[model samples]
Target: MQILLISCTQTIAVLYRHVLEDSYCLFCSISKQRFTCLMSRKTAEVTL
Candidate 1:
């Protein structure tokens, strides 16, 4: 009874954590791409 409830709670917690982690990874990847693009443009302008 109690064990079943605890297991259910743990499962839900694990799923939520995974979702948050995935979102954070995606956000970082997008930001990193933007940063590099901006950096390259700046470097090109400097060279020119």
Candidate 2:
């Protein structure tokens, strides 16, 4: 059970890293409006 849990956690971490990389690449390719929208979302998160 402990080994299964460890592998599951590792898989989740790898998936999260891949998602972050993809999102960053997409963000870089987005236009000004999209960039501002993303910035606003980030600021909202910071406020929370």
Candidate 3:
């Protein structure tokens, strides 16, 4: 059960990342490193 939950959360994160990148790309030019940092921060928030 726990593993399933974790995998689900990770899948959601990946989908969210794709959406975010697409939207962000439309508005501004952000570097890959910055995008990664943003994603890591978002995932950290979700884990907490």
Number of the top candidate by TM-score?
Answer: 3
Instruction: List the pairs of residues colliding in candidate 1.
Output: none
lDDT of 2 at 39: 24
Instruction: Write the residue-wise lDDT of candidate 3 on 1-48 in tens digits.
Output: 112121223444455564444222212112332222133223321221
Write down the worst ten-residue block by lDDT for model 1: 39-48
Leading candidate by lDDT:
3
lDDT of 2 by residue, 1-48 (tens): 111111223333334443333232212222322211122123111110
lDDT of 1 by residue, 1-48 (tens): 111111223333334443333221111111221211122122111110
TM-score of candidate 2 versus the correct structure, residues matched by position: 0.20
What lDDT score goes with residue 27 in model 1?
15
What C-alpha lDDT, on a 0 to 100 scale, does residue 42 get in candidate 1? 27
Per-model TM-score, in order, reads: 0.20, 0.20, 0.21
Superposition error at 20 for model 1 (Å): 6.6
Candidate 2 shows a clash count of: 0
Between which residue pairs do clashes occur in model 2? Answer: none
Q: In model 3, what is the error at residue 33, expressed in angstroms? A: 30
lDDT of each: 0.23, 0.25, 0.31
Runs with alpha carbons beyond 4 Å of true place in candidate 1: 1-8, 18-48
Query: What's model 1's overall lDDT?
Result: 0.23
